[model samples]
Target: MADIESEQAAAAAGSGALVLFSGGQDSSTCLAWALERFGTVETLGFDYGQRHRVELECRDALRQGLTDLNAGWAARLGPDHTVNLAALGEISNTALTRDVAIAMSEGGLPNTFVPGRNLIFLTFAATLAYRRGLKHIVAGMCETDYSGYPDCRDDTIKALQVALNLGMDRRFVLHTPLMWIDKAETWALTARLGGEPLVALIREQSHSCYLGDRSHHHEWGFGCGTCPACQLRAEGYRRFVAAAV
Candidate 1:
């Protein structure tokens, strides 16, 4: 994490960063991290026609919430970008895209894993950053505690950065604040970057459950707390809280 911290300090000290905001706990926290570190920060989201459009919809309310939390600081985060990836569902088939039970895929990976989703996401993020002359692109992808998505791995992102830079002939560094941290650390990150208000807001507002069930409430949020995503989030939150105590 020393390298990541150094890069983060540099990004914060330099121009600005563009974050891949998903309106979930991880991404929301990452947004705060970017805002705290970078001189200027922007956000982007993907409308990939997932099973639940709640995450996409939450992006706006989330941004407004950020502004509401710290108006003076939030305004510099820049305008939000929502790319139309509706056709992406045509190529990818998973519980995230279609109506399938939350189970495992053919290779024993989570059923919710949308093949190449991150690839497409980062590619678009890099392109957007490149055009905007932004050097850093931040994401909330985590490997320590996650849904078993391969694309979220650190190596995969590093490779993609290299490939994207080579293909576009531009230098765009991808920052993953939650790459090595678990969900618990993610919650801590939110607190560290945005304080208690942000931690509370994310716990109550961010939509992370794959089932899209917001009825059952917990310390971790409105997740069903059964889906793979929910389970990870709940466990992480529990651990984070326990450790803090």
Candidate 2:
């Protein structure tokens, strides 16, 4: 059968991957995948002045569990770590970083969209990758389940990849493991890579709650079930668990 177990282990030994981790469900899953696929796994998280401090909390919790970096990956590879792009956070006007009241929109970018957030994050990541000599930067962004966030789209990532290589002297590669996969498939991928218990930990321990509410459904991470992010998560988990049985 080629031993799927052995195959996964081999994948873990072959490469070095740096994840632009956000400590959310998607990014955490990507971190787990990187752990299993790369020999040297380092994570970079942003401490941008975002409205959701819960995101920071989740990042810390995942780092404690993963222990990938020496003392909290955020402190190491964050904006304060390699680059000094602190002004981006200060300048952003999006609801994610600002105190803007988010009103849901049916089309176009939502209030949660942080202008040029991913661009800045990825650009910084590419710089870090250049000095470290790492070839790949992994992210957990998804167009399938995300609100009309323009940066989460495939075209944006592809464009950024080209820009990174042209702007920086390094030939860097950007890998979005969850780009094409829907939320249910993401759950399955994490479960297959890290086992059911680990997957459950990701679902329960990680915070996806945009509203910062911990008392949501136990199926997924803590997010207000009413938010767009939470709605997708709840629906995805329901479909995932149902399909598993």
Candidate 3:
């Protein structure tokens, strides 16, 4: 088993990686993480008709910003692809896909939880990776300090990895660097990866608010500050800053 795992890792390292970048802090950090490790790195985004579709707009700038931060990153960064998963929005009636209120559902999960979102996302990403001859799929899905999205759990990702490999007959490795880290650690990670310039780029450009608001700018970033995404990011930034002080 160890040897097989080593073989898989070796194969993945050679074939480059595809990062599921959402123009959010976590995904941006994950992109940098992939660039640091992989020889070739590409990005993929989904147009799921999300409320914060504005995030899609930030993707290009974020990619270019990362390139400008490091010459090596610019050389390794490859083409980006965006898929139109608008049907997801048409089928899901939730806060993320619709204009509904952001609250906990009676079932306990947040309304922002889009059913089978990560599952579908990974499946699509694996399909693209296969087409692009990329054996590694990197995502920013996190269980720690998240909004209780079941799909973001490590178990879900691992299970999906197996399913994707079997379904595609390809050994595609799913990399989730943020699976076990909180938002504070996530901020620190960007700092470690690209220093203050990358941190400032993420703070100024990345969009995490569910309401799609970019008018308000806080020390952490731009958001309404009341939404779960903004609150988590803001509190995490506070903790990260306090720890450094």
Ranking according to TM-score, highest score first: 3, 1, 2
Model 2 spans > 4 angstroms off: 1-14, 67-86, 105-107, 215-217
Candidate 2 residue-wise lDDT, 111-164, digit = tens: 787778888899888888787767778998888877867888989999999988
Stretch of 10 with least lDDT, candidate 3 = 6-15
lDDT (tens digit, per residue) of candidate 1 on 125-182:
9888888888889998878987678999999999999999899998888989888887
User: What is candidate 2's local distance difference test score?
Assistant: 0.74
Best by lDDT: 3
What's the distance in Å from true for residue 133, model 1?
1.8
Error of 1 at 207 (Å): 0.8
User: Any residue pairs clashing in model 2, and if so which?
Assistant: 209-223
Better of 1 and 2 by lDDT: 1
Which regions of candidate 3 fall more than 4 Å away from where they truly are? 1-13
TM-score of 3: 0.95
Q: Which residue pairs overlap in candidate 1's backbone?
A: 12-37
What lDDT tens digits, residue by residue, belong to model 3 across residues 1-245? 99998886565556699999999989999999999888899999999999999999999999999999999999989999999999998999999998888999999988999998999999999999999999889999999989888999999999999999999999998999999999999999999999999999999989999999999989999999999999999999999999999
